[model samples]
Target: MKHNRKLNIFLIIIIIVSIIPLTSCIKDNVQPISKTEYMLGTICTITVYDNKPESVIDKAFARIKEIENKMSVNKPGTELDAVADAAGKNFVKVSKDTFYVLKKGKYYSEQSSGAFDITVGPLVKLWGIGTDNARLPSQSEIDEKKSLINYKDLLLDEKDSKVMLKRQGMSLDLGGIAKGYSADEAARILKENGVKHAIVNLGGNILAINTNTNGKPWNIGVQDPFKTRGDPAGGLNVTNKTVVTSGIYERYFEKNGKKYHHILNPFTGYPMDNNLASVTLVTDVSIDADAMTKNIFYLGVDKGMDYVNKKNGLQAIFITKDKKVYVTDGLKGNFQITNSSFKLMDKK
Candidate 1:
């Protein structure tokens, strides 16, 4: 009886030790706090994998809404609208957030040599590409709007944080870069709230806050521009980085057997007629990645590759209509093509 009692005590100790780890595993696998909202004209999702309460995610979403309210062109009485309303009149003071985005937009506009301009708002509103009233405008209408599409006319009074449009009809539509900024802001909120790992996705502007719950890099799927959403042509492993794609498939309308995308050319006041279907930029900052997409796409595959290779700490992938995947030298080994239909090109 004494021997049996000793064996029973040993077995109980082993069982309790095993169950301790099991409880910890259960806690680790608790469903991450995920929240989704539609603001800024796109689906925004903030997912946290830690034990943090849902308030953290809500705070992130709130930050995005604040940014949208400040910079949204569709919303009247917004800071962006105030600036546009005062175009060619007087400089309007804007919030620090608005001014910061405008400054970044102008910098990229100049860097891309006006291939991507923040002042393309006039042409964007005329075409109404993503709106219900989208239609093709006459040649004269396009030319008239194109004249107001120069980034040089966007005057920034840095000292006062005031902005003015040199032309009366010029508008500032941040559709190109606002979401990226919002995503970054959301990530900031999550981090400040002690979220160690999270995914902040504002439409296609995907930002990974940190590694996944598994302590590995997050896997971000590259949208197949030719197919519907969720169909990935490839996948990229990213950690604490953002993956932004500027593709013709994102926003477009069909008219009389022809398809017109939203990424308009500031120079010609028309959709960019390049063979490239999409351009994906991988970087640490979502705002930079967001605006750079248009600039790189405008340059096409060859020049775009050259532009990306010249820059440090930046990588880009250009997917051409021919189904050839051209990745920058930095992303050569990092990018993997999942779809057999699309082939990865060899380095030149």
Candidate 2:
């Protein structure tokens, strides 16, 4: 039998704010080559402004599909699913790529003190937030899954390149970071193809390859969380950065007039209740930006700002439910407020 995943239960994938080329409407001297495909359960696009061959774009998407096949828990017989099926039994040796991602996932899970747990698969399945099975689980069910949700239980052997989930019921979901990793891989493929400039968008995990053909930074619109999708609260100028946002509005379900979002708290095993409407992370690595959105959201606005402020390369734009916005030091000069409704607040 085959497993058919409509929402993938563990798909942390969401279309956050997207990048908009400032001169997108203006015709360029040289036309850019682009391709869009539905992969990783999301629409992905690769646009190369260097007039690279269509084969290069195909290669990038092919790499993304390869990553999806290896890391996606939705697919049966995948390396990740095989490890999950054998959890608490024995170590399952995996490919170098899968092992590396698992190692990185564990690292972030530890850094966030289990707040961004990669082992939240059980909890995710219980709620089924984005799938046809979407429903509120009973208190006992939530507790049971929560008990199985522990990042510390995921063991990795570097020498053998094997992984083991300490509990039999535990599952691994890389949806949180897999898309970002894929976007990074796509960008690398374009760069390797000698394409000087491109934009890799893996369902809104935006990675700007290089500066624009005009030698200017790419303009990325930060979505107004309270407003429509294309509405921008502000814009960011960047050369080589990945932008990702996680918000309550991205995915949700309403039952009995109350809404349940997909961003589950590792501690409570429920939707996170916070003042933040959205948290957009700007970093050089797409995977970090993707995982950091959830990690920073776990910290809330104040502590999240403190964490990003101290980081050497990471910057954040936090929008609260009250419509207040705050940007880290690195983006203060590069980010411009374009909407009057959004008040840029001082980081305290």
Candidate 3:
């Protein structure tokens, strides 16, 4: 009996030693996670999950700060500030990133038939719709600025990597697409740092990399156009997709019962008076999604649908002045209309 007991004890020791290595290996192979949030003009959040240390989060935040410093028009002495200063003078040489963005803006301008123009800086500055100095500009002032608002004046030398505005008083404003570009850049940096799962939210431009912990799609809310801020319209569920919305309610000025929004029509040199109250676009590319939202908002329903249908892998939901919701066929199963007063109308 003593020898049998000894043999049983020896077997138990072997089993215990065998489990020790497996436990240690599991612990050593555990993934590291870090989340950082900073309020830069807009709320910016970067979440990183990998085997990297906490310092990686700081590096990522630093990269975001670099981009913001270069791109922010609100910041004095930035690259954007230089461009703004050169508004009516010689063309300013910008960073390659800025050049590339301006090229994309020009392409979108042509594609959207001038609906998406980066050269509307003059009008944007004039109206100051979102600022405390918001007001209506004179007809003569509007007409004069409209003359210089053509995107054709934007000269791009691809081989030399330079951008120039052919005419004086022409300016480039990336307000419509800068956040998306920044988010994409941030994602690239995180991926380079061995981050496989993350989300970068630069204000409304949200970019999700890889699947969530549960391997499910990210639930991104498209802000309700008619509803007040902080309310989601039951939103849409997106997977490997970017959702962006441009709405009149986002930035505007109301005077004498007249509402003037920040989104200006390049043709009329005034805020768009179309039936569209807001436009939300979903696509795989945040930059494209950002540009399309503005284009669709200005194009209104018929032309907007045509543009969306021509492009593959793009979907949109448009809210009209009457609170009517119109969505592309691709979004039939994904987008839900929450406002009862907002009826879903089929495009003919």
Candidate maximizing TM-score: 2
Q: Candidate 3's residue-wise lDDT over 1-348, tens digit each? A: 011222333343332221111111112444645453543344455655446677766777777787777776556787766766665566677788878778888889998889889888777877766555678889999998888888888777787666677666676677888777777777778878877766666655667677654555555566666543334554565666666778876566677777787788989999888998888787888888887788888889898888899999998888888877888898887766554666878864
Off by over 4 Å in 1: 1-28
- Per the 3 Å backbone cut-off, how many clashing residue pairs does candidate 1 have? 0
TM-score of every model versus the real structure: 0.90, 0.92, 0.82
Ranking by lDDT: 2, 1, 3
Model 3, C-alpha of 75: deviation from truth (Å): 2.1
Please provide, for model 1 over 1-348, each residue's C-alpha lDDT reduced to its tens digit, 9 standing for 90 to 100: 011222333343332222111111123565777766767876566767788899998898889989999999878899988888899999999999999999999999999899889999989999888676688899999999988888998999999999999889999989989999998899888899888887787767888877777777776778788964446788777778898888987678877778888999998889999999999999999999999999889988888888888877889888999899988777766678888999998854
Report how far off residue 172 is in candidate 3 (Å).
1.5
Q: Give the TM-score of candidate 2.
A: 0.92
Worst 10-residue lDDT window, candidate 1:
17-26
Residue 205 miss distance in model 2 (angstroms)? 1.0
Residue 291 lDDT (model 1): 93
